[model samples]
Target: MANDTKIFHESWYRIANEKLCLRSSVKVHRQLFRGARWYVLSDPFNNQFYRLRPEAYEFVIRLGLDRTVEEVWMEMISAAPESAPGQEEVINLLVQLYQSNLLHYEMPPDSAKLFDRYKNKKQRIMKSNLLNIMFFRIPLFDPDSFLKNILPLIRLIMNPLGAILWLTVVGSAIKIVIDRFAEVSVQTQGIINPSNLFLLYIAMLLVKTFHEFGHAFAVRRFGGEVHIIGVMFLLFSPVPYMDATAAWAFRNKWQRILVGAAGMITEIFVAALAVFVWANTSGGLLHSLAYNMMFVASLSTVVFNINPLLRYDGYYMLSDWLDIPNLHTKATQQLTHLVEKYAFGYKRSTSQAYSLKEAFWLAIFGVLSGIYKLIVFASIIFFIADRFLLAGIIMALICCITWIIVPLVKLIKYLSSSPKLERIRLRAITVVSILLLFVVGFFYYFPFPNSFRASGVLKASEYFVVNSKVSGYVKKIEIEPGSQVSAGQPLIILENKEIDLQINEAMASLQESYAMRQLALAERPEDLATVEARIQAIQTRLDRLQHDREELVVKAEISGVWVVGNVADYLGMWIRRGAPIGQIINESAYYFASVIPEVHTSRIFDNEVKRASVKLVGQADTEVPVFRYVKIPMEQTILPSAALGWKAGGDVPIDPNDAQGVHSTEPFYEVRAYLDNNNGMKMFHGRTGKIRFELTSEPLLRQWWRSFRQLVQKRYHY
Candidate 1:
């Protein structure tokens, strides 16, 4: 067994003055990321070692006294003489033995001191506990590790992980705050136009920044490095983050913890300050903006960063707090053991290295962590429920099966792979696959509905589901579906028992009262005032009964016919009270219209409005004469007739989305004009003509703004 192991061992080392001197067969490779260089060395078949990180070197210094002869298998190589002049690098020190031409005693003492300075000048590296970890646990204090460890970290001076991270967090957070306030400032009390879930959104965004910045600046100040601050899209929403991997040399527990909490600390400060200012201010856009800013920063962090269920800020914090080598590995092992014991119901007859107590604790933590994960994952799924939920379910199912099946198969084949990385890589690949599938499948599966050019005909009519005031059966269908009618046109006749009863009761009372008035007047002409009062009561009763009967007749309030509803459904068909029999449009004056939902706009322009040809309903199919858009005040209607029907001149309504510099209308207003008709026929009362109102000939700046607004609205809603 020893002989077989020796073949893969591939190295032999001897110690001199507690420093390792090695003679090995391991091969090596060197590389760079931008200007930063790194090296890799390994046994021929397995046990790959990657060094060049300052942390690895620090590990060598701190743990060097305990390494066996076999562990001294690698060294970091650099082209430059990293140390100051007259000092030898670690590479030169370790490899000096290979240089055969050497004179030890013959060399001058000064020369010897220069050669020895490489090891002699060794600075005692200190490792501090990360402030971030402490704050994560306590959350009340600032993360001071970033500032304290900056100079101590030999490598971090050049890398800005800590700075980059916190700065990114601050920037992202500020942006979110600004955007939130910009919106909140626009709305006031009693204003119905503000955004929905506006406050929640603000809070969530603020938290995102705090969490991200905690990572970035933590790395920078903790002796790690960072660069970019960005927003990542998980299905639909934006999540901000900063890269902070520079603090590895800051091996102290405190430094790592500080980096973790830096962002959170900043978030706390910003949130607290924001609220303080908000409370002192009066109600306005500014105050609303402040409140939203603070709220977003604080809550988002608590909900997102405090849960150690995933390999994020919270996870790292938990790992440090628990003193675990790897949280994920422990979870995985416990899960496997759980399966073995509960699923297979196996009895352990063999002794294992893990004690029962440790296993018990691991099991408990694992289950709790699993529950946390369930909640977090559920939240993520819900957040992106629109398109990603289906994909998440399928991917999760596949992953569960893979976790069970692949690990067993991998035991022999890729057994050398690190368990810590396997699950992470699996998740990365799954996310990538899901995103890729969305990209390809979205275009293939969800084909857009047919689009028509937008007709200038803007919808300016209020809709009502006309209900019958009286219970009735259709006695007449004077106006058919899509037919125009007068306001007083008889829509239907009801078999109204209640209305008839009311009329009869009212008529009998009216007759009695009138008879009493006649008797009173004849009895005493001097009491004429009393007789007049009786007469007035009779007249009121008669008038009320007549009005009730007229209401049962069901006349059209406005002129247009059932353009959208069917009266035929009510024809000879019984209707109950408040049953919507049909709808009607004004005949002499009508507003051309279409509806545009927030989701899709291109469809409106391409399919309905731009390539539109207007014609009165029942007109011939020839192209209508196009007319330029005329800006007119809303609420004005251009009726086709005057004394016979409605007037020819009326005001028009403007589109709500379009802004008019002049506050012409109170509340909300629209700009519309007399709808023109051109389908080779004249426009008539109750006829709908597709109007092509040129809102703007969007080009240059206008075109760009439109595109920009649309992009923001569709993806960001800001």
Candidate 2:
């Protein structure tokens, strides 16, 4: 039920439920009149709200109006012996109510109008605050505004996408292909490197940015401003993001639909043009453009941008055409109606939306959708001293939870009071409690804390994985199976007889010197001096021998993934230093890896650590567990290498605009996010799942927005 008061805490709600008795000295706003303790009241029956100030209460009691219109209407139709309900009386009552509504509407600047005006002003203030929240006072995402925000030098960049936006996507791809295949002429060394594909990919991203511009352009043709344009991530994958919330404000539904369709149309046209140019052209420039064009145009914009089920241009497209105020709302309403019809056997109507299907969907998802929106709002509102505001939110949430639970609680109380109806009440309470729990759990916890749970592979450090250096015949390997070793631990011993003999000779010399010194104790000058010299020489020999002994030890230089191998153990086996042998990998190594095409790479944001979850296979099946990255990779690889591992990089997607020129020709960027469930795999590598990365979305002005929308729709509601 909708309430249009300033605010009410959980305590007021408890008072409404009689969980906490109303206080006589409550600091309620008072006027010259009688009073009743009604801090807030929810009219769920009609999904309407009434603000009862002291004066309103006084007016009601003074008029002795014992019945509201809804109550009067009910009374006339009630099957009571005392009540007379003839056709004439029913018609008269209906006429009277209509007359009353007409009178209420006619009164100039009446209470409702004044209330609405006050609400409108409140909305204006709220809107201003929200605009500031998103980091601007007036959030106008016009073309001029965009150009102004971009660097002066960047203005040199052609918005070729604007002319034929998707064509750029196609053109870039074909250009890259032809450049690669049409035989590299004796020219710049830089042109030959495959790593150059990364640049083409970046160009594709620039094109997609204009793809959003196409959407904005269409929307602006009507009146509303485009407030936002940027990359969007759903799950963790990137998508060219844009905010078209402004389009809905237009009077015509067709305008909204046109705005939704604009981007896809633009992308398609661009992709087609790129294909055409590639097919017809034969010059070096043309060949390069044509080769890359088709892939970029089709891959980025076609496959990625048109998936309505995935929440991109497609989602808005469907939402606009269906005439749903919001697709998300409609989805929830539709589910809610399903639950009501099948689950509840067609019981309740939904508070939001037009039809049962819409309401049902919404109701089914009401708890989840509400929480999701709240979290998205939290992301945007984080700077609004959100923690302090969250307390208020928590209180408000508790009040809603209590409202949902009240019916079941009352039913339980009734069942306890009367044993005969216990079974019926029990069934009713069970269903109600289950439904209520859905809402309660949403408030308590579900998506908020767990939203960012994700994981990826950890790579070995460069020092950790080392091949055998200075190898000899495998005399003895020091480490045993399953043994853990520290850095510099002895792991192997090479046969070196010369070093062994030196050690023995040094020991013998030391012993001989000691005996001679004992024997020459009395010889003061010449004999004693000679003995001292001999002792010093022996000590030096021993030191050199020990230093040589270190070479034979073959110690482990680093700690990590140790690759154990069975080798040929023979006395005369040939060996070379820094040659092929068993490998060692650093257990604590890390790297970032991914296989993203050029189009999607454009959407990769820097410095924003997206959530990831890594999974490993195991013997026993278990619930999916998510993991977090220890650290973001310091450097991205220029060309795929073994040091980077798998050409795939550490499960971290290397946005390869530089590597994959194919995507540069696309009109829109496509990002794929892989989140792993690492809970079950103890003895295996990471397992992953697909996440539909969504860039965060929001209404420009969130606070009390639906409240204003409701006010407008109320005028039109029959």
Candidate 3:
């Protein structure tokens, strides 16, 4: 309900009796937001929409040629005094409508003023286009005729039956995709390769064309015209786009949402079809194309189209779903209202939100959008800079001017010249200056706790691997895995019948040679010496055979816990010479081996390490402290264990071709920190964990700058 008290500006009072009315060309549409009735005034010629409150809508509806603005105001006050807009609000509403070309005066308008307004609007639009050069659009032919021609053919599928069919196709595609997920994932990595760039772009174009058509067709299905179809230069790449603003006039929220969602739905359907093709077909050009289509379609739909942070299809869909039109503008207004009302003590500043819940959403969205825009813009600038340095620098400067400089200049202008700040300019300036100083001081002077974490694995200080000394068959398993065994303890028992037979034959030969030597000794001394030498050779051969037979049993070389991967599988199996049986890990002495990226090595060496702790992946609640540490100077591409690589579902990236997942894509410095074992932490040889090194406290701003520089260096090799 509007306040019954009538308040008007002195200037508004001068024009209170002026005759004004809504233009015949302007159309009004009723809408509801947060359970409150509101009206949307649209200028179809200009494709502009302005939302009005119930009281304002009532005032607009009451205006006519027969009654002056004063007459309408009096009649409104007499009818619904509690619900009628005050004189100040009435003047403001009329000004907004007139500015929007939605209102007309009884008197002839000044041609010079009208032309100046038109030129100013054009200049603003052109300036916006120039600022957003990365996403500038080039309008092509109208898509309405093309849509009309195809509307009849696709009209049948634009219904419930088509929805069911789409669901079925998507469901089947999902199953096929799941079955071949590994294959698809591997192929997706090649999409960004220079060799595949052409095909990838082609696929992207085709998919986006389909996407835009989906929007156009959906609008046409709902009795709306798609006047413009164009190519948007998104990040220097041309992608199809369409203007489906006719859906804004939709009365049904769901209809508007459907139109917004139709593009994504179409892209998903194309991706589904691509999935089927890619799954059934063997490796070839067609298969590659299909895969690229599926990749681009799915990726763009999720990352861009469906992301509500972007002003894309998902943004509109979300707006309609929440019954909040012009969500972005309203969110900005809410933020401005907060700053004015609380920060500047502008008590008269009214919130754009109808309720607390709406205010909360608007505030949250406002902050999120601002942050997201900055991140996205910065990322794009960096990405382009990495490739084309000079072009990237120019673009960055332009973006900085448009996004940062312009806004700051506008803010300064508002603070100095805005009429609303006239009464409390000094107070506002003092408050704003203090706030800015506080923020800068907090970021610069404050010492924040600094820590960096890296993935690592717990490894035994020493490991004793038990291997077979001779080729034999495993006859018995003596010890189970994880069992503590003493040095020379039998871990596995093996039997070899061939070695036993050889030993027996050598023993018999030795006995024969000894007997012959005795016989020769009686005949001749020289012959006896030769026979004795033969007997000695035979005896040595027999001794070697016996030693080989005794080597069948495998024993632990050190006292530690036995770790056998699959001891049961080796039972009764032929063991090759030097084949590993199991390992004896000294769990009492353990250390965490962490791989630190080469870029972060400077920070590690520069800062004094205050403390360190290790948290096992699964048991993250427990933190084991490091007693001592040693940094290895060597740069290596081979990961210490597969548990710390991408192939094994870990955070580090490794060569996919490596079967063991041990080969890292980038070289890293290894650091081993001795763990305190007194806590009786269950230590495994290759248990994956994260090791955090606490460094000396530093200002947050400095830390962030360091981290950002490190990121740039690592990603772009700058």
Q: How many residue pairs collide in each prediction?
A: 83, 83, 0
Best to worst by lDDT, what's the order? 3, 1, 2
Best by TM-score: 3
The numbered model that scores best in lDDT is: 3
Estimate the Cα RMSD of every predicted model relative to the unseen true structure. Answer: 21.1, 21.4, 3.5
Clashes of 3: 0
Q: What TM-score would you give candidate 3 relative to the actual structure?
A: 0.91
lDDT by residue (1-718, candidate 3, tens digit) is: 1232246555554555567788888888787665777788887676677778877888898888777888898888899877777776776677667667787776433422323445476678778888888899888978677788888876987989999999999999999989888888888777777789889889999999999989988999988888889989987899989999888777778889999999999999999999888888998988999999999888888777897888999999999888888889889999998998888988778787767888899889988988887887887788677767787879889888988799989888988998889888888889889988998899998999989998888888888778889999989889988899999888888899998889888888888887887778787777987887888888888888888877887888899999997877888899899987778998768889999987778877777999998999778988899889998888999888898999788889998789989999988999999988677867778899899999999999999998888887786677
TM-score of each: 0.33, 0.34, 0.91
**Model 3: how far residue 298 lies from native, Å:** 1.1
Runs off by more than 4 Å, candidate 3: 1-6, 34-36, 64-67, 106-119, 378-395, 501-546
lDDT of 2 by residue, 472-554 (tens): 56577678633567678876667767667778888888898888887788554458788899899889878866765665566
Residue 215 displacement (Å), model 3: 1.5
Task: Count clashing pairs, candidate 2.
Answer: 83
Ten-residue stretch with the least lDDT total in model 2: 13-22
Cα misplacement distance, residue 432 of candidate 1 (Å):
30
Q: For candidate 2, what is the lDDT?
A: 0.45
